[model samples]
Target: MTASAEYLIALAGNPNCGKTTLFNAITGARQHVGNYPGITVEKKEGVHLFNGLKLRLVDLPGTYSLTAYSMEELVARDFLALERPQLVINIVDASNLERNLYLTIQILELGIPVVLALNMVDAAASRGIEIDAEELSRRLQIPVIPTVARSGTGKLELLEKTAEVAAENRSWKPLHISYGADIDPVLDQMETDIAGSDFLLDFYPARWIALKYLEADEQVINKGAEVNPELSSRLEALADHVAEHLQKTLETYPEAIIADHRYGFISAVLKAGVVHNSQRSDRLYLSDQLDQVLTNRFFGPLIMLVILYAVYKATFDYSALPVEWLNAGFTTLSAWMQTIIPPGLLQSLIVSGIIDGVGGVLSFIPLILFMFFAIAFLEDTGYLARVAYMLDRVFRTFGLHGSSVMAYIVSGGIAGGCAVPGVMATRTLRSPRERLATLLTAPFMNCGAKLPVFAMLIAAFFPARHAQMMFLLTIFSWIAALSMARIIRWTILRGPSTPFLLELPPYRMPTLKGLLIHTWERTWQYIRKAGTIILALSILFWALMTFPLLPDARKSQFEADRQQILSQLPEDTRTSLMQPGIAQDGLTREIAKASQRIRAIDRAESEATLQHSYAGRIGMALETLTQWSGFEWRTNVALLAGFAAKELIISTLGTAYSLGGADLDAGMSLSRRLASDPQWNRLRAFSLIVFIMLYAPCLATVTCIAKESGAVKWALFSLAFNTTAAYLISAAIYQGGLWMGIGG
Candidate 1:
């Protein structure tokens, strides 16, 4: 189809209303659709080809209302007003039609064509609630298609109706709802004045603009003032007058009255033979019944802990073999490259830098996949929402919103999420102080990038206690994040905690298709990073550690030492040792001793060469302070690379160890090398894990924080603050452990 034949249709809905699910069903896209809110913080677009037409579908953020109270609401409202899509597919939760239709009424006010996708009809039926789509369509004057977005039911019909609506090219006709005797006259005057002046009429309908002014929406008010200051001021004055009148007579403001009437309108629509509930009104639904035990104060926390531990245990148990297979595969690849590629800079770049470095991170792919699968399952089942609701009580104690729990969870509070999305998720929080606090602290969660580092350390040192160590680390992360949030609130971002109302979506069994899609999407992102960003950075770090060759004198001294060992051997033995693939069993004792000595000399020289390099010097400089935490020069180099990305800690360590003569066996993995190193004890491994978990976030996340928070200072503060906290905690643990003679 030609570009001109394409129709732009926007998908709109309240949070948890299956809007994105329907979008995915239509477009065959795998956009992250979560059971809870705040997953789609920005617009995602995909195309659908039907017959001779191309339908460009845009999935807007899920928002409860069109008012500018949160970033989501503003984004949805702005896109509809400015972009003016050909039609909007408004998905509503059929089970909770009244609450979902509040946003629908606001969308209708925009005077755009809308086809109501009555999503989750099966869920509604399961709950014994029935909705007559035809009657609802007739009353609202819009096509209402009964749908179960999860199963792709009625999606074709919904698209057909959408195309029909677009083909009509219908004129924009705003829906009008009565606001009662108290405020109707004021709205009439405001709407007429707005229409007469043509103020914001290019973007918004006249009556919608008036309603925004009445609602005291900051975005619309600011835009109005910018467009025409005099008209905006007059409207503001009129709005204030009516607001005062309403407050005096009804003891309520215009915004509240408007909301009440909107809900009232929705109620009236449902009451007009549109919805029938077969279940008794007094009976509790399945969700509420489950919430009774799942959300119980005592039992909820216990269940959450048990579930989290179980996920970790299952991940470790199931993924162990695959992880080993991947590790062995990478090891084989590195070994084969070492033999095939000549011993030179090119060989070093491929085998050590690219293979070993990126491979070390990639080796943990199985673990990451398993962990992400568990998290996605929990999220899809709606248990994560319940977890958030339970966490709200603790979050409030730390001067944070209940909404912040999801941000932390996304940041890897459960162990396999990213911090960039987590930081952006804070935009859902209304309180600026709480949002900033959330943005700053969310990075402390054990994000997927850091998972490899922790997994490696725990495997090497606490092998038998894989799940236990991970569980402890998860707890430690929460404690550290919450403690830091408390400190932030007590000082710079201090404020009273705002009340939070968390909506718990009904629990549904996660489909195999959905779980696999979510898992693969996240797992693929990790793999892509290893191949691209991690690959590039690994090569760069290798260069930094490789250049500036050893002086000629130093090289000769190592050569002379090797020659002396060889010179002592008999002539035939020397010739035999020099031959390729000389059998160790065939060698005499004298020749074997000489060969071992020469190999030791090579290893010593390799270590010295690394110590003389540029990266080694920088690592040496930090060693003075890092020594307290048992970190030597090599670990320091890896940690420094971690600032760019946490996953680099593993890759850089791989390169560093491989280049630093840890090539005892060509196939030895990084974790094994660390376990065999005399310097890395259990205490030191635990200390390093703690430090890595709490250190500065990756560079990408730092930049996101700066942009999201609208300040460079906060980003800088995160860097300085997180590193300092990490150092202090790690140092204390290492020093205290030695004093107590534990894990020595």
Candidate 2:
């Protein structure tokens, strides 16, 4: 059904309520996650057909109150005021009745029909506490449905009540907290002033804004003045009068009175409706005991490390076989395509460019999927919150909030695989400075695209001894991130740390369905990006290496030189050169024949064209810049093209090093070739690895950073810093190696 024609149902609630779970259960696969019109905070919408009516459910971000202090509060208020959904499913936690009810009262003031879903009734009941749902329904003048959303209980009843409320088209009267005589006169005057103003229609009530103005809520005052200039001055006068009469500060008077009234109302309601048991139980005592240990000062970090290691080992070991199978399958398919298609540009495009480039990168999907699953499981089980608690002390020293530790850890493992969510996760930090600090350091983590480069380098340079080297490098990345985070925190994000006030959510068994869905969403993102950006870059790299082939004179001269050398060689030496040993004879002959054919083709091309073509000129330019680091022109070209996408490094190597063979691998592997080169050794290889590790993030990562941070400047800064770091480190390592006589 069209959006305009569908019945709109808004899901609104306080933070930590089961609103999200209820929304997910009701809508299932028909959900789209986005953001509010003008805010960075997330907005979720889902559509489902119930009783022949298409219900469009919009899940608003969680907020504590309708005070308009935070962006989320403003977005929630604006959506309710402007969009005016047909029904609001107000999900309130049964355990935290009073705090959740404050938002309910404010929402009721908006004159919208609300169906209360008293969620987490089971948790409350398990604690030997009970709420009379019927009494709550009567007192609030709304249909109250007690729900255990985690298990999908009372969902149908809740939906039925929501539809009933929507069909009735009823609005609840505003419930105002009565301020005593001291401030009542000022509130009345402000109300009159607001009612007489031309912009009165733009707001709910001038008295509410005036009350917030009296509380010195700068956000509300600014917004009110923007809507009606007269309102601000008049409200300011009213606030002054109230403050003077009450003998208190303007900010203190309103908040104190409002909170007292709210608590009083909640107390009265609880006295009438709730039954609390006195006895404590084994489960409660056990949970308390566990919390102490899990959130302990010492054990928490140790446990977190063990958990992280387990996740990595599981992802790496379990996915290795599947990844290998996928790579092998793609290789075989590419080889088959070469055999079917004659040796030409089309065959090169399909085998070397498309398959070896894109397909090679895509084969790592299983690993990505496994990692995402493990992350989702941790998130689902609520262990992530404890992780945040454990890292709070250390993170606070860096000027980052404790919550940012999770974002840093997640982003560090898989950088740009999906930075948007990593950035979004920063919302858990209360301090803006901490959030910005986390965002800046997040992309420094090695991402999935860099995985293939690391794998290739490790295989080539270290061989069977590579695992420990790989682990050391991974740890080094974290060390670098920690150091950078500390630097940025002190220099750029300097400020007082906010208090740690995170909620330790109860652990729940993770749902396999939800875990799988989240895993697939992230994995699908990687696949889509690889198909578009990575594939384009790979094809472009292939084109750069292929066109305007080698100079005819250069090729002929080299071939003639090689022929003369072979002709002059003794029969024994020639036999050794030509045939080699029995084991190596077949593969060596194939390579020799392929090299001869490439020479024949190069001899037919023009010198000027070969020199001026895109690849040659680009390589020449990079060679000038990279000479200090000892990179040959060809290696420079590959590294330059690799910035678009790291996987392209392998593809570029394949194309540049190809010897007119049916199989790309028939030529020396990029690793083997680099290792054998006189100019490169272990030291240069190590430096190159560090360069790749610290270089500018791929195109997708930069795009994600731009989108998430909402500034091109920050993305540019990340690129500049990372690229400079890579270059400086590589230069240092190379120059140091030369001084030590390790390499030329």
Candidate 3:
């Protein structure tokens, strides 16, 4: 069907009213998801074809009321009014008809065509309640269709009814809620003023905006003021005058009373057409029992921890073999390329730069896939909402809404995937303070891109037994985040916690297609970033370590010095130093004497080369400040480069060790290398690991923090606080270890 001629159906409902389920059932996998124009709120559109007709369905955000206290509500209201959809498919939960119908009544008053899709019919039936759809439709002067959306029952009928209503341009009769007489006159005048505007008349019925303005909805007031200043001022004055007449404050207007009127009307209709049996169903009792345990105060935190550990284990442990295979394949490919290509800059660029950089990212694919699958399973089983409900009380203590917990959990998997969505999730939060606090701290959670760095570090330092250490460190990062969140909430973000009101939906098996899509999307993001930013940085790091030809100069000087010393040692000794094989000469004896002197100079030259390089200079500068924490210049340089991205720590160490060509099996891991160095003992290694764990987040994380928080101040604070903490902890580890005789 052509776009203009296609039927448009908009899904509108209150929060937790089964609207999302209905949308999912109707659209299935044939949907495009994005954000609303100029806002972060999700927008989902899908095309469904049934009975030779095409329908373009739009799913609006769940909103309690259209008064615009939050962006979600405002977006829902604005889209309905401005878009002027052909029909609004109002999905109201039958079990909670009173609260849900309030939104339905408001939509009816907008004078737009609406078809009531009485969703969750099964739930209502299980509650021993029955509603006569025909009788209810007759009373409301609109069509009402019963639906169990999850089971796809009545979906076809709902669509047919929607098409019929939209095609005929059916008008829904206005239902009036009786606000007290004291406010009626002001509403009437405000309505008249609103009617004068062509823009208001084209979308929303004049009466709706009038009621909203009388209620002092900032969104309506701002829009009205922008459109017509005079009208807005008059409306404000009318609201004030009405408040004076009623002897009440303007902002504390009778919203609850008006709400009660709508509920009263709903009750009257229900009494006429709805019936309820005496007994409650088994399903309801079972669901309630499960909710109690899952959301219980004492067991909730423990449950959350267990679930998180399971996710980590499944993602890291189960996928270890596949990740290893990928790493081995890349190594084999790099080795093969070395033989086929001439040994030059191009070979180095392709093998060490491109292969290493891209392979490093791809190696984490197993973990990324598993993480997404685990999240999908939790979401599908409805455990995610339960998790939110359970954590509400605890999260509130830190000025974070329970809903913020979801963002943190998702971000913890991959920090850079989409901070927009992570921040957007905070809309479920009721308090502005909690939302802002969550937005600030969300980026600190390690994302998928950081996984490789962790893997590399753990593998290098604790190779034989690293998985458990990696898991423990992962848990430690979260603990640190929670502690920091508490500090911020109490010291900087002092405020009352928002009320936790969440709905726990029934569990269902997740769709494999959806799971795969989500997993691939996140995995692709990690791969792309590594290929671009990480790859470029790796090449630049290689250059910094290799350039200016100091090693070559040292080798040339050593050869010349050895030749001169050997020449004086006699013909046999000179022949031995010049020959390729040690066995061919008394040559071997002469060469051994010369090797000792050359070794000392080579060590000195290696130190000088490092001190003269760009990275070395920066390291030395940082060393002056960080020496107390047992950080040498090389460690300082590694830490500095690590800020670009934590995964670079591995590459930095590899470069420092000059082992890019060394076999993984043969080369000493970073930990072992450090352990062997007399200057760096066990205490230093432990201190360094602790410092890495608590250091300032990588550059990508900092960017996400700034974007999500909507300011540079919070991002800078995260960096400053984390870096300071790392330094202090590292210093303590060093000094404490010495004091305790763990290290000298």
Better candidate by lDDT, 2 or 3: 2
Which residue pairs come into collision in candidate 1? none
lDDT (tens digit, per residue) of candidate 3 on 1-744 = 344567778999976566777887777778776778867567889988766567899999888777676677889888878887888999988877777887888887777688999987887776676878888888887899999876778998998898777778665445566676666676776777677655356656777777776677787778778888887888788876765655564344545546666677777777854646557455455557777777678887687777777676666777778877787787677667766877566765666556654565666677667776777667656787787777667677666777787877666622223334565566566666677677656655665545565665555455555546655665665666677778778888778776666667655455565556556545665666667777788778766755554567665876687666756676655554443223423435545766445444545555666566777778888987798788888778778878887667655654554322222212233434454556866577667776876778777667666765678997798788889877987898888888899753
The TM-score-based order of candidates, best leading, equals: 1, 2, 3
lDDT for 445 (candidate 2) = 64
Error of model 2, residue 666, in angstroms: 6.5
- The superposed Cα distance between candidate 1 and the true structure at residue 249, in angstroms, equals 3.9
| Candidate 2 lDDT by residue in tens digits, 549-583 | 65677657766765665675455545544321223
TM-score of 2: 0.81
Q: lDDT tens string, model 1, 209-273? A: 99999989899999999999999999999999999999889899999999999999888888857
Rank all candidate structures by their lDDT, best first, as comma-separated numbers: 1, 2, 3
**What's the CA error at residue 375 for candidate 1, in Å?**
1.0
Between candidates 1 and 3, which one is better according to lDDT? 1
